[model samples]
Target: MSQPPPAAHHAGHVAVIGRPNVGKSTLVNALVGANVSIVSNRPQTTRHRLLGIASVPGGQLVLVDTPGLHREGGRLASSALNRVLNRAARGALEGVDAAALVVEAGRWDEEDALAYDTLRASGLPVVLVVNQVDRVADKASLLPYLQRINEGREFAALHPVSALKRTGLDALVASLLAQLPEQPPLYGEDEITDRSQRFLAGELVREQLMRQLGAELPYATTVEIESFTEEPSPKAGVMYRIGAVIWVEREGQKAIVIGKGGTRLRDIGKRARERMEQLFDAKVFLQTWVRVREGWSDDESALRSLGYGDS
Candidate 1:
């Protein structure tokens, strides 16, 4: 007699929440096994919430990667962009089957406390994912830290993982799957994320800008896809023709992004184009320009125009 396959009925959404640089996006990307989210060391790099879908054998897990929480201050003290990003982060938690509070392996901070407070307030079954454990020099030091944090509040599970190195994720996924609701897959196995190729292309450009520029400049910069059109190629079936603007807050910032002889901006465009070609699996003609949208980060309309906080 042929037996039926084991039930893979558990499937649900998991909100990955954390403080800045705690590796929430990295974990989400690693879990989905794709570049569904962009990575950068700069705070506030993820200005929007993202959904990364993963299809396990019996079930599926939707990983919601949100902006890292931080106390508002500094040039961003205007509180407009700050509000929008935090709202995005909070929105990701709504109706999620489970939540993962990511934190550095051996450290805790005020922002981590804020994240924990938010998770506790939600009353959802949470998993404490200690990320970047690979950087923990003293391997034996993690147990006591984990024990102490676990005592702070109840968690459905505690798993130490290195999202960057892809270690211990299998166990983490199994634990997360167990906590999910008994259901079928929400997204098709072939589907990876909710974001469009155009959006990701802009993100890849923004990511390179973030990586190439010094710390302060990345904050002043935001990438906007002015136009993205597709046309049939002579050889290939299709190719993407993209025109984007890198918006900055000031004239001096614009000069910096453009660089001497426009060399820097061209380099940014070249790398971004290469990334887009790989992502779209077709030739990409990426035309990028640096423009001054003074104080766009603080302006509600400018942020909206750039696709922040909108469906």
Candidate 2:
């Protein structure tokens, strides 16, 4: 006799919450099999909740990548960063089937404890993901620390994985799948992320800037996709006209972004154009301009206009 059919399954959302730079973005990229969230060596790189959807055999898992949480309020940028964290904490995890609290292994400290406290208050089923195992000198040494951290919390499971090396991700994916609720897929199976090409193009430029200029430039910079137009190319056969505004805090910063003889800005534009071509699979006509937006991070109205708030 033929066996009964397997039960149909549904997709669910899973928020990857943790302090900044713990490889949360990398994990999301790995899970979704694409570069959905921008990754950089710098901290606080992700300022928004990037949603990446992964399709499993039977269900889909939506991962929400949030900015790293930290103490704030002294400076304008810090205050904005704090607001980002609060928004994620208050609503990002709600209605999700489960959450993966990512922590860097061998670097656990008081900050980790505070993150745990916040997660505990969320009242969501949590899974502890000890990321960056590759960085630890003695992997065995982490077990004792893990035990202590998990002492009081009621976590569904603990997973030690390295997002950079792509180690133990299968197990992490399996654990998340088991905890997901029964529901239909929220997005199409081919869809990987919710961000638009223009938004992603701006992010790509910002990522390159972060790598080249480091913290000195990232916090002071914002990329806005002013216009995105596609038409038949006069020379390249097909052309994507992408316009972006690079905002800086001071005239000096603007000059620096433009660089001597405009070389620096040219480099940034070239790199951004290349990445956009790859992402969109077409030729791109990229135009970038640097403008001074004094204290934009501090101005509530500016922040809201930039989609950093509920404006």
Candidate 3:
């Protein structure tokens, strides 16, 4: 008997949407099997629309990881920055075949509803992803929560998963792939993301900023890669020399990021360099400087200059 022919391949774009801090980036990173998107405990960690390609035996998923959908009226809100982030998230819905509406397991709120509404309005297949299931102490309680949220709502599929631990992802991936059109792969199997290495490098540095600075750091702070260059290395094969500027809205914020005697900045650079080296598979020499930008986050021109307006 002849062996059965290989399964037909499916490929298309799927937007990952959720409120801030709901593990959307983590889910994207897990699905892509790489750190294509940065993750932090802070809300709005992702400020851009990034494509993470996940290739499997029968299908390939082009995952559009987007900024968290959030309200912009809070005291901590940076109006321009928040608008940019929200726009990036909503804009990602355009030209997508499906959407993954991610929310923390056992909880759903107005922002979550907002994300679902946005996806529904696009007329795309919305797959409800209840992420972070590992944190749910009582697995039994999850059924009730899932049922409660599913009431009077429509979803192509629903999955309870833990993006951090990589559990329940196979089913989720299958559900998403099922919704995609049957076609050839959109990208090479080796390709993981559409973003360039330079952009990833800058994001890695910003990840350190959010992780290290926490609440003390201003919400308006952003990272700009002033310079990124590669050189041949005798032992490491390649080396990267990256200069990053940490843009802050106030001179006092600069002092805070710099810390006493520049130690804080040094630690941030050290950690960022380590991450870049790991991600790029090369040696990294990273230099970081904190500078005052005087409300750059709220300034459209400045935001555009700092690479904030892209979708």
Each model's lDDT comes to 0.87, 0.82, 0.92
Comparison by lDDT, 1 against 2, better one = 1
Give each model's clash number.
1, 1, 0
Model 1 gets an lDDT of 0.87
Stronger candidate by TM-score (2 vs 3): 3
Off by over 4 Å in 1: 2-5, 73-78, 216-218
Identify the runs in model 2 with alpha carbons over 4 angstroms from their true place: 76-78, 233-238
What TM-score goes with each of the models?
A: 0.96, 0.93, 0.97
lDDT of the structure predicted as candidate 2: 0.82
Clashing pairs in 2: 10-183
Tens-digit lDDT string for candidate 1 (1-311): 99998875788999999998888888998999898888888877787888999887777999988998887777574468888888888888888989999999999888898899999899888888999999999999998998888885888889999999999999999989998989878888999898999899889999889877856464767889999999999986899999988888888888888889999889989988888888778988889988887777787887888899973
Lowest lDDT block of 10, candidate 1: 211-220
- Cα distance off (Å), candidate 3, residue 254: 0.5
Candidate 1 lDDT at 254 equals 89
